[model samples]
Target: MSAPSHTTSYYAASANDKNLRPALQGQVEADICVIGAGYTGLSTALHLAESGFKVVVLEATRIGFGASGRNGGQIVHSYSRDIDFIEKHYGDKAGAEMGKMAFEGGKIIRRFVDQYNIQCDLKDGGIFAACNGKQMRELESKKALWETHGHNNLELLSDTDIQKYVGTTRYKGALLDKSGGHFHPLNLVLGEAAALESLGGVIYEDSPVTRVEEGAKAKVHTENGSVSANFVVVAGNAYLGGLIPKLQAKTMPCGTQVITTEPLSEAQQKALLPNGQCVEDCNYLLDYFRLSGDGRLIYGGGVTYGAREPDKIESLIVPKMLKTFPELKGVKIDYAWTGNFLLTLMRLPQFGRVSNNIYYAQGYSGHGVTCSHLAGKVLSDAIQGQAERYDVFAGLPQYPFPGGRTFRIPYTAMGAWYYTLRDKLGI
Candidate 1:
């Protein structure tokens, strides 16, 4: 029952659910077929199942095998682009609806945990650390924007105040989202998978969908079998390879690295991140860290815009970790891993339908954990004849990277470098 296909992450090592499900062999039928087992697929299928619909999920490898299992684990709110982008580019009405859903994703996660009694070691508190005055000012504006949407569970911490939440003096200040938190991401997905099963939902591992034949009843084909269903949900995110040519062209997959250190003693934990909340610094390419349930410091940062895995993950991450926690110089790193996430030029999630019956949601950038859950609910609402919220997302314009496949990486990396420099010069 071991998940051999899953990445050798700290989460996989400490996974509570190792239940191996059978792969698709023969043709199966369902009300809806979800083509990924990550958060988006699980959330959509689970929501549909709860509404008394027959749901079947086909995972290419294993549950939480993608970014769903291996992320910063911070329950951050809002999209990567934030609400201002929506209001300016789209309109105020779209902005209002998008704003309402901004904080609901985290709430949905908590609701699933309490309603299903899923044991994922959920924790409280998350901080947006600012390394400079300009970043601190940006945090102030971000706080105001969230407040305008009626989300008020936030506190602005001065440099002195942040030192209590984080042991390091790297931050000039921070914005604390009391509703934002962290958890065992893999366990959360596994628990939700169990919750989906409780509603008679079915999931198949090692079931890479080859092609989805579009129709009133789309046929989701895998290597060995197929699923003919009333509707198809394409929720594979970055790992979804050439299945849909149109989708592959609109999004680019990018890699992010994460590492975990040997468990720290109680005193060690107290000295670093005394409040035990997840912390992500304010930078274009950011560094995020938090204390794991067993006291290990799970630190993650850096991005490979081209989706290529770094040759040495520890080399890219260790020095950064030490920069944040110099006291932990020479600390033993127990795990280092890299995973891919989908990104868009606009930095907003791409939600739409293919041929009217096949629905899809992807391109979460780095905010997949929270946004994917909201996507699931919105996608379900659309399928169940409630398309208002879904249209709010689908109506947004989607643009392909300007450089095409040949130079998109360099182009995106160049833009990121420009922003990173802005962060450095405090401009």
Candidate 2:
């Protein structure tokens, strides 16, 4: 089947400014060559350019054409996996270090927004809503964990308090993190792309890296051109194919779908979410939604491992929205689409060197909105010979799917079905 088109998301339709960059041509040489033009690749290019390194970035399509452009745009400061999972797998100290590293993702994103004056309609509040007693207990435990870590500004809310912000009683309780927020993810990436250009960095769109030859210097090949550089960074999340075989074994592509409703009037918007905070339910198969700056309801959920398209994505997600806000039964959905995300077995970001000079990062689960920015900075730092922060993530353990490349899709689908069943049973 042909790949799904970029979603007619509120972000894509209402982007503040859109520019089409030219594709690659002829041979080129740079100090560093980065693949993928999403958040991770653009962020790395911008930082490296600022640090006085000659940089070139190659993208398979336009910038933000992948999940970076199509996501629900929630810029939360945590990973999709829980903190307890980290503590249990690693030691307490290692868990804390990972927690701190993940938390810093939010800081880096906010700082970039402020420093660059990117107008992405950023909002500064978010809630993790609980649909059942078990989920509420989990939220409370997470609240306590944050407090124990001296991270203030995290408030525990009863169902009543949650109703004030979310305008729904479907949830039993919530954990409100003031630092967690949402923004226009596409705008964030485009602004970073512009910043990189301003610093003399080169970017070539529609130039998919077909092959990577590893050695003291790496050679990346495209149809019309090639880039030979001292260092090569692979930042393509799910769209990257066969560029690096070993890295592909360590990750599986998972599909996620999203839909957006037409703009509601001011009063209708107020009735939907009075506080304008992004909200998501607590379930293994989660539902996340938030109002766009233009008053559209941007709701995203549903994960599938198969490449086959869903018969109806908007229909699948609209009922989930109605379950949260029954008042909007007649609301019109303007757009719906799906994107792929790279998921690792451990559900952590995977970072490692393919060879001496070829570094790669992927498998951010569903948290790439902010984590990609953090990954870019760390990867850039590693290319510059400072590997402390990069090592923190690279040192983490990763396991390839049991069946390797050929069976990854089937195994991931089976695992997803099990999780979906557990979610349905409220386990």
Candidate with the greatest lDDT versus the true structure = 1
The estimated TM-scores of all candidates read 0.98, 0.95
lDDT of 2 by residue, 83-187 (tens): 677889877876787777767777777887898888888999889998888888998898887766656689989989888898887988999999888988888
The CA lDDT of each predicted structure is 0.92, 0.84
Give the clash total for candidate 2: 0
Q: Highest TM-score among the candidates is held by which one?
A: 1
Task: Please list the residue runs of candidate 1 whose C-alpha ends up more than 4 Å from where it truly belongs after superposition.
Answer: 1-4, 305-311
TM-score of 1: 0.98
Residue pairs in candidate 2 whose N, alpha carbon or C atoms collide under 3 angstroms:
none
RMSD of 2: 2.1
User: Candidate 1, residues 263-357: lDDT per residue as tens digits?
Assistant: 99999999998888999998989999999999999999888853334348888898999998999998898888889999899999999998789
